[model samples]
Target: MGLPAMAIVLLMALLQTGTAAAETRAFSKARDAITEPSHAQYEYIVVGGGTAGCAIAATLSEHYKVLLLERGGTPYGNPSIERLEGWADLLRDDPTESSERSPIQAFRSADGVHNRRARVLGGGSAINAGFYNRASDAEVRAAGWKPKSVQEAYEWVEERIASPASLGPWQKALKNGLVQAGVTPDNGLTYEHIQGTKLGHSIFDAQGRRHTAADLLFSANDELLTVLTFASAQRIIFNVSDENKQPRATGVEYTDSRNATHFAYLQDGFQNEVILSAGALGSPQLLLLSGIGSCEHLAEFNITCHVDLSAVGAEMVDNPINAIVLVSPNPLETSLISVAGITHEGVVIEGASGGNWTWQWPGMGQLNIFPPLERSVEMISLVQTNLQNLSSNTKEQIDQSGFILSKVYDPISSGTLRLKSRDVSQNPYVKFNYYTHPRDVETCIRGVKYLHKLLQTPAFQGFRYTTVTPIIALLYPELSSSEGERTDGAYIPDLKNRTETANWCRDTVTTIWHFHGGCVLGKVVDKRYRVFGVRSLRVVDGSTFTKSPGTNPQATVMMLGRYVGVRMLKDRKIAEETVNSRN
Candidate 1:
């Protein structure tokens, strides 16, 4: 049916929006590139002015000279990025060809699914839906962060960026619907990720203005901070220690927007370091380019081996999303993720409304769905044929639709990220084996079943149709082994059957853009986030996560930057005092 194609269309559209106008507003401490008479040495050189990068750089600059390099421009006047109403435009306006100046970079995974990453200074927070929630207690315990410090870090970020969400009419219905469906114990409004239906905070303010990690820089000591825009990091410069023979990251080689080369280095202090906060994809890709991955893999691209850390780009994971589209009887207002249903079964329920897209399905007819850019033409043709045969009345209802989707929360199935080319701008080959693990598939089935229960509730009864199989199960009716008869002589899946539900999950699985785990903690980096084989180098981004922290990762990623920055300051102070005592 066209529903599967339409669902994919909706998901992709939800993840992306249009490009922002290029407006450069000069920050007192920021520049387009390394200016002449640049500081020869920095106590910290942070590559990637993204969510974590911005936070960590701001924190470190409190007492140290910090250099933050962002591959894209500022978000100050970018309407598509700074205003929440511009969300659809920012994601829907896909570029015909890749450009280095775009705020959002699009890529296709080896799984043949389209995904996106942020190139702007604020990173994903500059482009995402602005959902904000703290990591669960279990996630904190697993990471072994002290509770008191973790709380302080979260509060610090919250005070600057996070705020209570403004629930619209549609969001209010979704909240009640989730509660009625037995998600249990409505916690009202809260930022903590607990097991229940709760209204979480958002990074978008009451006026629908987005506050990103870049805003955190306001707290930074401007005299000690220097942010460079349009600066792409090419590789790390390392020097082998004379005494220990261990490679220490000494500097970084990067190119400016004009293709001019520049290098930034660390100070002479033992604690001076270069940190990589380039997200999951960017971080690992940089490692491979710098020859920190498997020696054999690096040799294929003619890169000299540095650390031979085979785990640099291994075990990549992404949370798979399965959604059900609902055609509202009346036009609904547009909204992003707000109300949440965090279930005990490892499923997180969220919804949005008023998303509309129209496509000219090749050779079929004009349809109200736009497939992801990378979806094969052959598949599109097949979907078009099926959609053409649909009754005119059915097509009309689909044009006005919203979506209630569930994420796999913590997926177990993983894959790898390998270099497609040595160029840092080009996307690496990444394959997230979604639904490959039995448990992941089973968890998705549970989520769908839960969604089915919600649609059956009184709050959602207005959208339900008894004569046909539920709209939720319409995506992949043919894939299911068990069938339910529709009045129109169409066969739909009986989702009540476990086997059918499992098949539905596998057929329609897609990403929620929460991919992580390329450079995992304890494997590639130590618990302190420092690379195992190298000194004066560390990774402090989502790439260091083995599992995502909460319902969303943006808040946690920002918190981590602050948390690690504070820890680094404390470590340096202790070392200084110890030296002073000996003297």
Candidate 2:
């Protein structure tokens, strides 16, 4: 029974272990409100205060004047975003207490899958599950970034936010099950990409404090950095008036918190640039709005197409997860999200959680799992079928909970991203055509079966119990119904008709939000993270990924910022030194 509470969030430490206090000061300053300077020129402008944005702007600010514009406010005062128990709260929208100005934006994919995106500073890292793992070597190679700097980037990000999590009872059971199932040689706690079971790191420290990417700014030269929260980048302002007109990016048009329009220009040289770290959704959407996407789409908004690149928003992919919930007979208190293992196929399996809102009848032998919505009256119909023998008096305790999540680390099938409208305010059309490829669907199924076999091993005999009903059946009871027409769109788990399983996976699928590859590397942007056909512009967020990495992408996204930022900082310094020598 993989009872899943679907939410993705993260926090980072400092650039070095000894600098934790300095990192705290950096995060605190980012949390503190700063006045927007009246002057509008900067050597570099980073759009989006997200995981990558904070890192990029902070890193570059050390050597040059930089401006970071985040559409949402700082994450400091909000408990819903900063606490561990509030992890799930980051995903759920609060209509009564929230407004359109709220930081977390709820969106629906083209396939009708619903999820959340963070509009706040620190972006998804501050609001995610806090699982902080570095990307697999495969991801680093494919991203086509400089290879040596990969470790440097990882070390840079790890120092700021990484901490090994102590395993709880549920996580201990998970490790035992995996080791028993031959899925592991038991790789202990690490931020490295290992083949077997390992105790992963988290952004939360021993005292439960959250240090996000925003904390990394502490390493930057604050005198050269100006962070403007609640400021949204609307479009890249191109210099069309230049002779030979190669579409040089000169500045950015933006809307402040008050919705007032403003334009911030770059310093005079070509070295000055506008970096879009607005994330997968925001980056591509901004490109399309700024007249850089497919000619046909931009034509709809009557915008002049400067660059007719068809792949600006192509190859958007997400980790479509399969969840199962199991109930434990005893209080299995150890910790939350402490243990994880990798299958031979690179699939990731993780243990239970306490932050979710699941209901149970306990000894009465009944458990209730909630999908984001009831979805259909039929989704939970079969959930109670396996619990008929227990008594009604056993109180549901958070300590006794057991559940797990299994996700495909290397997903092959990807979707496309397009504009809903030219407006920066509207969410884009994201179609994750998940499980569209045979290999992708096959991997997900193997992951489920692998974990299922692992959990049944003797290692879990005392701490966990075999679930009574198949989770897929419980999630989509319509599959079990003979009235096939009523459940026409549901997926069936039988191997004979894998297409049915694919359909079910698509219909019931939810993202762990490791969304990648929009404005992909080698497609929309070059290996250097600069946009093709557009000068002085680059993308430094998850949107630049060529493919999804096999673990939580938060660490990778932050590393990318550091990797790119370090290069840019070094290059600009050399360029400036050469100019001074010539003078």
Candidate 3:
């Protein structure tokens, strides 16, 4: 069976299940109740109604009163959100025109691909391509964490969501074609499996639904949890102790749809906790505005520093993914697959010195047939030296390198996130510093060459494939001649305009929108997900990821949110029980 047949079969199966899932009633009463502001004060305040925020709020409301603050208005049965196929179309439109819009606009990559980030009530999850990958055992072990730490929480989440490989005939054909190519399988289970192989189509729930965190959080019976849509937090109110003490976050001050400014504080007689789920961009900005960023930067803005942790906005990492889109001669489409489906065996030959080495590299060593140690050390030394040299300001040289490498490969550029201003309204300064590392350019170059090899395989030989990148054409017109050409088991001609190709690489290479490492774990925050130097405040979003997870981070974010929420709830129960014993 191929991809199209698999899709039809999957679609039919989903339609049946969807009928039952769709029949489940939404919270009509609560939806109506919160439309007006007369509702009672909530016990917990969850800022940013995004992936993690939604999950945290939903779980917390199960046992305690909760309030969810969303800057965007309610989706209110948006058809675009409920339907899976509708997402392909929705990605092409402006998010601002819809009920919600991401603060950062989706930018076109150098190769003319769009990179989108969601700023809606459900955050990126609502607008994302509904693909699911789980973290592999190696990934878990590499992070030096136990599965028990988050296993039960992940199991509970998986029960509600499913990833099934129900491919139709056409889909299966495509998968088989990929297999026929040198692409090999990866032996791990995780969302966004980036191990050398590509496998499995992303799975939707039985009801053909992409399970956003909002779906998990909102329940019909939870009247105590009040969801306030179209409400954005302007600032968090902190209680100053004496003249020289650290200010504590008590509550948040916000503005509602009516333009009315209102303050939500801890209840008169109860201890309240404020969790910032405002995402990597929003959370760091909120902290800076509330005076919790670097003391030097905050002082420049004439704000007193509450905490002077320099790591609050450092060591950012994101996967720089480049896509190779080909037009299949047959009407075939692509879907997510397991890593085992695509990783090539013996690709990393033993004793292969220089770049092919992987044995000593911790992240790459997990693969059984990786290169030997000496080669790995050589590659590491070369990469470090290249990075050190390129870190200096040499725009012309870097640009030249970016273009040359990008034409035939993928680049591994690194960047940083810095505070642009103290004002919460201002966006953070994101300097991608793309192509800053020489090794990144080398990696990208290697990746492109590898892609070319895959394209030459019998599976892709007859496809009406062309590089869709206009920049590639503009720079290397000779290469464009082969665009839309069928492979004839012969080497394609090199670009006639090498300088033009170099120029294109220098100018056109762009980012893959995997922003990470603002409030990194173990540095800015403790292992428990609580921000360092701040009492009773925690960050449970992408910012907590210590390093970029090397794939789409939606599943990891969801897992982290679930883990933190469950832990917090368990600890709270223990504390309450201890108090009861004393009483």
lDDT of each: 0.78, 0.69, 0.50
Provide the TM-score for each candidate, comma-separated.
Answer: 0.88, 0.84, 0.72
- The candidate 3 region of ten consecutive residues with least summed lDDT is 348-357
Candidate 3 off by > 4 Å: 1-41, 94-115, 142-145, 165-174, 186-198, 201-203, 206-208, 219-221, 243-245, 268-271, 333-413, 419-426, 465-477, 480-508
**Model 2 CA lDDT for position 315:** 91
- Winner on lDDT between 1 and 2 is 1
* Candidate 1 C-alpha error for residue 109, in Å: 0.8
Global fold similarity of model 3 (TM-score): 0.72
Clashes of 2: 29
Candidate 3 residue-wise lDDT at 175: 44
**Could you give candidate 2's per-residue lDDT for residues 1-583 as a string of tens digits?**
1233210000000000111221223244442222554348999999888899988888898778998888887777566555555554454343222354586886767654456688888899887768888877766776676778888888888888778776766677788888888877898888877789888898877755667887787777878988877777889989877657579888888877666777889989869999999999999999898999899988988988999899988999988776544445566553446677888885888865442432111110112223333333233323323333322332233224455666878788888988877778888898887778888777877775675576567877765533323333433353456522221112224544556545545544666678887788888888888899888999888887766564678888898898999999888889889999999
In Å, residue 174's CA in model 1 sits off its true spot by: 1.2
lDDT of 1: 0.78
Write candidate 1's Cα lDDT for 1-583 as tens digits. Answer: 2446554332233222233444434456567884623336799999999999999999999999999999988888787777766775555434233788888887778776557789898999998888999999999999999999999999999999898987776788889889999998899999899999999999988877888899899899999998999999999889965646778999888888888888899989899999999999999999889879999999999998988899989999999887666656665566788989999999999987664331122211112132233365455444434444554455544544566777999989999999999999888999988888999988987887787777767876554444444333443243233344221212223566778667666655666779998999999999899998888999999999988888999999999999999999999999989989999
Scored by Cα lDDT, where does model 2 land?
0.69
In terms of lDDT, the poorest run of 10 residues in model 2 is: 7-16
Note the clash tally of each candidate. Answer: 8, 29, 48
